[model samples]
Target: MRLTGTLDPVYNLRYVDSVNVSYYNNRLLPGGGRITVSVPVHNNRFSAWVPPLPAGDRLVLRLRYPEMPDSAGRILDVGGVSLMTGDSIVELSIGKGTYNPRLKKFALKADVVTGEQNIARLAYLGAMRLRNNITDTLRKKLYEKTIDSMAYNTAMQKASELRDSIDRDFIIRHPSSLQSLNILETIIGRYLNKQGGWNASGNKRLTEIDNLLQALDRSLRDSEKAQHLITSLDRAREMKLIPFTGIMPDGSVFDVASLEGKVFLIDFWGSWCGWCRKSHPHLKELYEKYKDEGFEIIGIGEEFGTGKEQWDRFRKAIAADGITWPQILNDPARQDVVSDYMVQSFPSKFLIDRNGKVVLRVLGDSEGLLDAKLKELFGK
Candidate 1:
């Protein structure tokens, strides 16, 4: 199928500099075609021109500035006229022109955006959309429940799950009526005031929490459109036996591809794991000695049963401990990485080589042990 963009900022991007774009073997194109473009910003409005694109293909903008990638800056990712931060609003035009009504709209490439809040928004929107589509997609695919049951119960379940998730991970300051991640105690507190559930008049607390979370996440931002594409992208990757996003306790975003070019030792852990946090100093020392030589270690925390609020606590714990490498939050929802690496314990590490291949799978984390390995591998 042929693919392209539209005349919208969400779809349009002109290279501010030519050095940023590259071609991938993922598709066949000449001159290292621009993978993704940052729609230009001017006035209070931001818009990008997307050439007429085919429906099922994926596009990712390698947003960069001053010859370096904007690691923390927000870039608008949109579809149609929706200006957004972390996700993309699917163009009605795209849907009308390309997608069939019976098909599911899932994102295939989520990591294209490196911005943290941006990624969070993208994932949040994706989850919302996924929740909405349970009747249309999951139930049909899995044949689990009726559409009516999936809609009301599934959405409520998703919101409740989301509440438990961010309650610890994000320092939510939102009004109880504002949204879920903004404030859990407040949202649930308000829901309690609503008499609980759509039909209940006495359990207001549950009602308010459900409504508030629903409002904050409705429709999603344009940036999430890319994220939606990524969700679809993961299915494609699964065909290749690659893992999608893996949730960890650090609550940080993890990308299997981003670890390229460095030797990475990934540790799956938890804050409650006394053994996990204990490995930090040694990891710091390892990073200090081999960082220059291209050896690195990433801490992936498993907060699966611990839920979401633990994520914020997890980050604070790291800050309190002075953690210095990439970290990711892990949960049962996204634990493919752990399964992929076959992690059997806490403080587990998978030592990857410079070429991004898994080299040492069983190497235990020993204090000052990485320095010796670096010396052997790169001769420090």
Candidate 2:
């Protein structure tokens, strides 16, 4: 087959990337796959071209629907424009609906929506290039402040702060873009601050002391940070400010406070969520050992597809694959949990003691560390 190519700066780029997917059941090793995204620069519309598969595989895809990234359009807080910021529609020409593998194209047809904000992303990249020499201390401060402010809801603010946080070399490698953790924080932080205030008090004071502390926290909080967001979310749940309930595996429901007297593991996941399943081995081992010690692993299935079919398959997958732990199919994802707890990524876990207080919030590998952690926590 011969492929013809043309350069139409706005509408001619057909790009795709490969992603690694893992089974929640811990039995299958992660596999790599491809996703194609079509961005019509002229119409500002985006479409995804999912790979076609056989019927059985297709069913699995349905049960565990992939979390298609929003082509920078579905960026939760694009440009620091939060749900809280009104009249801030930054007109992103986003096409709705998922890729219909049957049709091998987007399901809802190609069209444009009113609220996509890739502009912030563009501005963020531009600013990064313009001011590539910000000091680390200031950059960190900007990161924290951006997170604190929730500027991710808007494009301009996100672009500004992100520009400050970006590293010069990263862009040099990928000149068309310079994005990652720093960008997420700066944009997301701003959005969160404006929309919901990180599930905690805004700390909006203008005092020097507060500003200094904010700077310090921002500098100190880096790629290694954990629990801050989770802690904030937990605090909000305790206050009963949000009228929300969460769905657990087994198709049950409960609020965070309801599971108070148990040792619980809030596993953040989704059916099409590959990263969450990546930690199955550790989860399995942890459950096997500590389950007898009153350990209850309540997986808060995030994303969509928390139904029985998916849950059962997930459970079976883990069991057949070596995980014999109890799981609650989580619904509404962990809205309060993620927001209050400030969970930003997947496979993140929060260890709760019997009395219902968090012992630790883990962001990285806990598979090998689970046993050691439990022993220390159990004082055995």
Each prediction's RMSD to truth: 21.0, 15.9
The TM-score leader among the candidates is 2
Q: Give the CA lDDT, 0 to 100, for residue 177 in model 1.
A: 17
- Segments in model 2 whose C-alpha atoms lie over 4 Å from true places: 1-121, 129-250, 254-259, 273-275, 305-324, 333-336
In model 1, which runs have C-alpha deviations exceeding 4 angstroms? 1-252, 304-306, 363-365
Q: What is the alpha-carbon lDDT of model 1 when measured against the actual structure?
A: 0.44
Reference-based TM-score, model 1: 0.34
Error at 273, model 1, angstroms: 1.5
- lDDT at 179, model 1: 23
Residue 191: error of model 1 in Å? 50
TM-score for each prediction? 0.34, 0.42
Candidate 2 local lDDT, residue 279: 78
The models' CA-based lDDT, in order, is: 0.44, 0.40
